[model samples]
Every structure is written in structure tokens, then in C-alpha cells.
Target: MSELTTVARPYARAAFELAVENNNIKAWSEMLSFAAEVVTNPTVEVILSSTKTAQELADLLINICDDKLDKRGQNLINLMAENGRLSVLPRVVELYADLVTEHNQEIDVIVVSAYALAKKQKEELSRSLEKRLARKVNLNCSIDKSLISGMVITAGDLVIDSTASGQLNRLSDTLQS
Candidate 1:
């Protein structure tokens, strides 16, 4: 997966630059997302893995995407096809989305707690995180009954594990030490 990400990064950056230049990041994002879905289809996967020529693969993708892809998007397909990089479309889309998020100065945060958070609680948390992180926060909340109490917050590389289970584990480790 990491190898695919490495291979896809350059293409993603190129696509992002093109989008930025044209002020069409939204369109590019939609096109890339649609193309990724096409490449990941089970039937398409079989054809992609076969001995078809790069041109054939590229044509198949463009035809399937049809009106969803513009001239620029078609050019991207041709370029990636020529490089035998069509299989990396999904990763490319993922990286492109990350670039868009960074450009927007936004962060996606996941919060896992023993129970669902109230609307007011979620709003407060969002404001607090925005102040601390200096970016707009998009919160995704889930419940994990095993957490017992408190919650865990994850944003990019940052993680705050304040759950009762987490605390108990730490205390156990300390006593054993």
C-alpha cells in the first residue's frame, strides 16, 4: 500500500497543480473520484490486470467515465496509462483529497467515546479543536462501549486516549514496572 502511495504521489501532485492552475479543484476531485471508482470495479480490475495495451486501458476508463471527465481529465488518464500507473488511481484520489484538505486549512477528526456525543458537546469540541489546531475541524464521532468512559480523539498524527480502559492499562503497566 505504501509503495502504491509513493508511486501515486507524483501523479496526485501533478493533478492538484493542474487543478489549482485552472481553479478547478472541485471538478478535478470529482473526476478523480469517479475514475478511481471505475478502476476499482471488479470487471474493470480484471481488464486492467490483463495484457491489454495501455491505450486500451486508458480508452476503457475514459469511455466509462464519459462526460464526467473533461479534456484535462482525459489527458491525465492518457498520461497515467502511458506510465502503467492506472492501477494507482484509488491512491491518487486519496492523496489528492488530502492535498485539497490541506489547501483548505481543514482537518478531519475522529472521536470515539462510550456513548454518542450530544449536538452541543460536538459543537463545543469542534470550536475547541479549531482553536488548538488553528484549522477548521470536521468531527466524525463513533461509539465504542468497551471504552467504558471518556473518549479518544484522533486528528492526523495526534491522538488523545483518555478512555477508562486506556487509563487502566497505563496504571497496570506502571504497577508491573
Candidate 2:
């Protein structure tokens, strides 16, 4: 993980706890997504990386956020500002997303294939993976033609590289050895 992600862990954990407690995971997800987007804007990104007062930066962000945050959302933003972790907003959001999904008993998987997959294909893939993994699978698909054929599926920290390119590389390595 990156330094920013390491720095953001506590904040994301706290937000996740609060969201789970209130059964407001979806709301918190949206709020964090919004916060991340706001922080990534060129103006706000510079402000966050500068020596400006936290209150000033918070005010500008709040204005840009435009009352999108409820009480919990406000608290998350304040917490980030107070802790000097304003720049970790993006990673914080990602971690929060993982927490929420895991709490909801879902496993997110990234499926990278050589070609574009249809909705039905993705759904079927999810079903197949869910049966094997024994968990509700959320499929995220991507296209990588260099794979030549097949797909690479990643869940949690595991990589199932079923793509021909990955297999060929492994075979080549084996032959070389």
C-alpha cells in the first residue's frame, strides 16, 4: 500500500465504524466518494497540499460540497482536516468502500479479460466465481487485448491469471528454468 493509504487507514476505519453503527453504509460511501472527488480537483488538491489553514481549506471544500454531507459526513471531513490527512481522501474512500462491501457480505473481484464482456457474461462470471469462492461476488471487468484470450481475476489479494498471456509467460519461465 502507498503512504497515503497507510495514513488514511485510521480515518477510514473510524468512518466505517460510524457508518456500520448507523446502518448508513451507502450514505457514507457516497459522502466519501464526493469528498474524494472534491479533494482531487486541481484547486482543492493544491489547497490541501499547501500551508493554508485547515479551516480555510475546509470552508472552500464545504462550499464546493454544497451541503451534500450530513452530520456524519461533516465529521469525516473535519476529522481528515484535523489530522492533516486531507490529501488521503481518495484512499480513505477506497478503504471505506471495501469495509462497506465486506460488511455487506460481498467480495469485490476485478476480472480483466482480453475482450469486452456483456452484462450477461459478467453476471454469469460472477455466479461461477461465487460458487467457487462461496461468497457473493461483485465483478469489475476490464479489457486487455494483450492477454490474447481468457481472463485474469483478482479477489482480495489473490490473482487467478487464467489469461493465455499469463499462462504462456509461466510456461516460458518453466522452460527457461
Candidate 3:
């Protein structure tokens, strides 16, 4: 895991647990997502990277976020800022989102293909993936001309590479061996 993820895991877990306890996962998710976006903005990033005091950093983030943050959300920002981990908010949000998806028994799947998939094809693919993974699947399709043909499906740590180029590479490796 990347250092950022390592640093973010605990914070994400805390946020996730709190959300679950409060039965406010949706609100927490929105708050984190918005905060992540704000922190990633170029202007906000410049200010965050400055040598401002921790309280100042927290105040800046809280002000920018306005009423988007609930009391708990503001506390999270204060804790992160005080610990000099404000920059890790984006990673924290990502990890927290993954936790929420898992809790909801859902998975986001990415399919990169040589061409756009038809509506029926996408539905079929989603159904197949849902059955195989035993989870609700959210399909995101994208075209990657380099695939030459076929597509690649990715979900969490799993990757299914059925592209023509991928097959050729595997076949070449076998023949060479």
C-alpha cells in the first residue's frame, strides 16, 4: 500500500464507523467527497501547503466547506489538520468510499474496451459480473483503442484482461518459454 493510504486507513475507518453509528453514511460520504474536492483545488492546495498554523488550516477548510460539514465532520477536519494530515483528506475519502461500497455489498467495475459497448452489452456484462462477484455492480465503460479488440474488466484487486493484445502477449510468453 502507498504511504498515503497507510496514513489514511485509520482515519477512513473512524469516519466509516462513525457514519455507521450515526446512520448517516450518505451525509458523511457527501461531506468527505466535497472536502476532498475542495482540498484538491489549486488555490486551496496553495493555501494548505503554506506554513499556516493548524488552527488556521482547520478554519480555512471549515469556512470553505461552509455548512456542508456537520459537527462531526468539522471535528474530523480539526483532528486531521492538527496532526498535519490535511493533505491526506483525498486518500481518506477514497478509502472511506470503498468501505461504504463494501458495507452496501456493492462494487464499482471498470471496463476498458477497443470500442463503446452497446447498452444491452453493458447490461449483460453487469449482470455477469454481479453473479460472479456476488455483489451489486456499478459498470463504468471507457474506450481504449490500444486494446485492439475485446475489453478489460477491473474490480477491486481483480483484473480480467480479455483484450486481443493481452492474449497475444500471454501466448508469446508461453511459446518463448
Candidate 4:
């Protein structure tokens, strides 16, 4: 996993720089996402991992992607194919998304609650998180009955756990200590 990420970082950074220069971050993001999906298809994965020549693999991928990828994007795919790095495309997409979020000065936050949140509640939570994180917050809400009650807010490395299960665990730890 770490090896893939290490190999993918340079490619993702190059793509990010190109996107920034072209002012086409959104387009590049969509293109990379589509390309990643294509590369991950079962047939495509088999082909990629087979004994085909680099050019053959590159052509197959480019043809599969077709009009969704621009010339530079195609070039990226070709380069990765030539280097036997096509399998790292998914990691590149993940790193690219992180770059895009940072460039846009936005952060993604996940809220796991026992039940659905009202629209008003979501808005309030977003507002509160934005104030705390000092960045525009994009909230992704999910339901987890195991939480029992309340919610867990996760913004990157910071986790604010308010769920009943979480509280009980903390109490248990205190008692144990």
C-alpha cells in the first residue's frame, strides 16, 4: 500500500500542477475519476496485469477511456502504462482529490449518527464545523445504529465522539484506570 502511494505521488502531483496551470481542476478531477474507474473494471484489470506490451496496454486503456480523457490525460495514462504503474492510478486519484480539496480550501467531514439528521440540523452542524475547522466544510452524513445515540464527527485526523457507545467506552476506561 505504501509502495503504491510512494510511486503514485509524483504522478498525482504532476497532474495537480497541470490542472492548476490550465485552470481545469474540476475537469481533471472528473477525468481522473473516470479513468480510475475504467482501470479498475474486471476485464481491464485482467488485461493490465497480463503479459501484454506497454504500448498495447496503453492503447487499450486510452481506447476504453475515449473522449473522457484529454490529450494530457491520455499521455498520463500512456506514461503510467509504459512504466507498469497503471495499477497505481487509483492511488493517484485519491491523492489528487486531497490536493483539489486543499487547493479549494475546503475539508470533507463525516458525521455518523444513529438516525438521519434534519436539514436544519445538518446545516447547523456544518456551520459549527466550518467555524471550528476554519475551512469550508463539506458534510457527509451516514447512519450507524451501533452508535446507539448521538453522532461522531470526523474531520481529517480530528474525531469528536458524542455517541453513547463512545461515552460508555470512555467511562469504562476511567473506571479501569
Q: Which candidate should be chosen as best, given TM-score against the real structure?
A: 1
Find the candidate with the highest lDDT and give its number: 1
TM-score of each: 0.96, 0.85, 0.93, 0.93
RMSD value for candidate 3: 1.5
lDDT score for residue 17 of model 4:
100
Better of 2 and 3 by lDDT: 3
Q: Which residue pairs in candidate 1 have backbone atoms (N, alpha carbon, C) closer than 3 angstroms, thus clashing?
A: none
Which pairs of residues clash in candidate 2, taking residues 3 or more apart in a chain or in different chains?
none
lDDT per model, in order?
0.96, 0.85, 0.96, 0.94
Per-residue C-alpha lDDT of model 1 across residues 1-177, encoded as one tens digit per residue: 899999999999999999999999999999999999999999999999999999999999999999999999999999999999999999999999999999999999999999999999999999999999999999999999988899999999999899998899999999999
User: Which portions of model 1 show Cα errors greater than 4 Å?
Assistant: none
Q: What's model 2's TM-score?
A: 0.85
What C-alpha root-mean-square deviation, in Å, does candidate 1 show against the real structure? 1.1
lDDT sort, best first = 1, 3, 4, 2
lDDT of 4: 0.94
Global local distance difference test of model 2? 0.85
Give the alpha carbon lDDT tens digit for every residue of 67-98 in model 4: 99999999999999889999999999999999
